[model samples]
Target: MDAQPSGRAMVSRGTDTFCATDGRPATHLPVFDGSLPIMTEQPMVIEDSYTGHVSPGSAPQRRTVPGATITKMSVGPMDNNVYLVVCSATGKSVLIDAANEADRVNQLIGEHAPSLDLIVTTHQHGDHWLALEDVAAATRVDTAAHPLDADALPVRPDRLLDDGDTVTVGEVTLDVIHLAGHTPGSVALALTEAGGGRTHLFTGDSLFPGGVGKTADADKFASLLTDVETKLFDRYGDDTVVYPGHGDDTTLGAERPHLGEWRERGW
Candidate 1:
């Protein structure tokens, strides 16, 4: 994706004109004077529903589950989705993909979570870790990633995650499921409710709304499809919500019927 230029405007006060950094036009603002009070930008109001569509520079959407609260934000030039999972009981949190825009990610952490315990990188793709080092250094939190892709990350992961391994935040536990294809160690994290309420799967780039993530060849595609079918689709129910690393969110129920189509198309 092409980078978006920062919005700027020229403000004229008295006989002098100066540049101002704001999306709003100078015509929209009242004339500035020494006697006038400064106007502060209002905070973006978060929406209630989880529509699965968020754009860069927009407010993050949030969803509250049985034991945790999940906040989704779209960041960077690639529009990578960054998720913040916070345990409702203890306020301890886990961040999934500090994808990009360190300043924006830090602002999100400061506003939404009480404490960030760990940051998990789903894969070693450059787009997925544009802000990982900065966020990790700022938060001073432990990091986790699959060993296969660990060496490629900017900051070495403190913990090497494997399939069946569980990551905990306060009282909530997320089960890791390795889905290889897009990368050597691409993984997905699943958080199942106590009963049979709903399961939320953070599939990273492995699974998206319409199909599996991109792969280099037929063999890789097959490997990803197989892992996704058995480890994800087969095990989880139709109601399972899928949160991908990019774009909008989806559910297994929504994409279940198209598994055959995706396989036949080989992508």
Candidate 2:
């Protein structure tokens, strides 16, 4: 894990290259040999964009799919990405990854707090749930995670999501896809619009834009990669929008063609 490049972008001089938040390949981005620089807070504002409404003056984040609106907020020292998945038709929503900063997360909920029905922790990694307990306590909403990772969380999850289980927000239901290796209980959520619209895949730390998530070793990497390819690429088409836990959002189409390249390089 230490081999993973820090989030900051710096001059390149190392073998360990890192991908930019956008979908660019690591070979095309900067490589750093030190820890990611200290993360600085920046003002984030919601503004309408072509893909969706993004937090302008900060990192470009947010995705508006057919039936839901997705928003991202980076928090904590680790720069964990938290997402808000809201159903546009019913306003019912779910908050994914309350990594840290309880007040900031609660504020993101804003007036829609009441419509929030679930607090989903993608996995039990401490960085992914530093503010889980506080946020869950404040929202008074049921928390959910895979049973394998539930025990690792600071707060007990009210709902245990299985591989094929589905959770509903108003009229929309999100299908759960269990993707392990990154963590024993890592999972991705998929949503399809009622009338055959675009599909959205929320991969916690399993899949990313340039490549798959960081694994402890080659075997773990292979397992994560295999799962992603079989369950995601092979199953979903190029149109599926991918909202990863960290960095920027990308689509399956932008990443599908590089599967062989990523596997051979063994990042």
The candidate that wins on lDDT is: 1
lDDT of 1 by residue, 31-92 (tens): 77779777553444667687889988888999988888899999887889999999999999
lDDT of 2 by residue, 1-267 (tens): 111211222221224433325545566656666788734333345444634323312443556767777777776665667888888889999988887666567667753334889999998777788777777766678999999999988789999998989989987789999997898889999988668777888899899879998888889888889999998998887998887877667899999989999999895
C-alpha lDDT (0 to 100) for residue 106 of candidate 2: 68
- What does each candidate score in C-alpha RMSD? 7.8, 14.2
Q: Which segments of model 1 are wrong by more than 4 Å?
A: 1-44
lDDT of 1 at 1: 20
lDDT of each: 0.86, 0.76
Score candidate 1 by lDDT: 0.86
> What's the distance in Å from true for residue 236, model 2?
0.7
- Candidate 2 lDDT at 235 equals 85
